[model samples]
Target: MSKQHVHGSHPDIVKRLKRAEGHLQRVIAMFAEGRPCLDLAQQLHAVEKAISEAKKTLIHDHVDNCLDDAATGGPGKSARNVLAEFKAISRYL
Candidate 1:
């Protein structure tokens, strides 16, 4: 299903994030409706996992594209460019 829609980072990543968003919204609504803690926790866990997977996918794409390009380039990449990009990625940690 996700293989059909590639946007932003990747199709799968976007799909996971969209699912997580839906779960998160549902969780919020459940909270408003005084839903059970146990059920909320389970849904929240799914949302968390989805968001985590999306983050991992986004990072993977960054590394695969930007870092890979920086690593293997004839003259397009510079030390400053790679260093800046690495620093940007470091902020995620």
Candidate 2:
């Protein structure tokens, strides 16, 4: 279905992902520049953490808004479908 508007925390999540993307790009450049292994590892870790936190925020927002809507009869999917969707999304977390 078409989205009606920006969901909760999505704008923040997008900003986080963009930051992570920038970090990842820097990490790639570091590799090419023969940066020290310790520096590379630290940068890579930051990138990984950023992506992980973004994923967590997205999933939590989905559960808080979408699943809550479905449970409250807010023009969402059926109960079975909602549960399935929740399960599907939870795998990423």
Candidate 3:
């Protein structure tokens, strides 16, 4: 399968990624400080959840703008292609 073409840069998406990055830095600092394993695990889980939510937001936006346009008879072939891509993405989640 091919990669889905994301439309434009989303500020919210960037913010989410930055938050995830901060979480990662925290995880590293915790490790360096020899923090409790449970605390580290919880932070890791939070990072994972944040990343997952960010991905969902992107997918939702793509569907709303690109996929919806295609489905509405904008271009038959392109619509089918985009629909397939969306389905593949759903599988990943």
True-structure RMSD, every candidate: 5.7, 1.7, 3.4
Clashing pairs in 1: none
Poorly placed runs, candidate 2 (over 4 Å)? 1-5
Candidate 2, pairs of clashing residues: none
TM-score of 3: 0.81
Task: Write model 3 residue lDDT over 1-93, tens digit each, in one string.
Answer: 998665675788889999999999989999999999999999999999999998888878877887788777766547669779789877756
Per-residue alpha-carbon lDDT of candidate 2 for residues 1-93, written as tens digits (9 for 90 to 100): 995767869889999999999889989999999999999999999999999999899889899998989977978489898989999999998
Give the best candidate by TM-score.
Answer: 2
- Measured on C-alpha atoms, candidate 1 has an lDDT of 0.80
Model 3, total clashes: 0
Q: What would the C-alpha RMSD of candidate 2 be, to one decimal place?
A: 1.7
TM-score of 2: 0.87
Instruction: Give each model's clash number.
Output: 0, 0, 0
Worst 10 residues of 2 by lDDT: 2-11
TM-score per candidate, chains pooled: 0.73, 0.87, 0.81
lDDT of 2: 0.91
Sort by TM-score, best first. Answer: 2, 3, 1
Score each candidate by Cα lDDT: 0.80, 0.91, 0.85
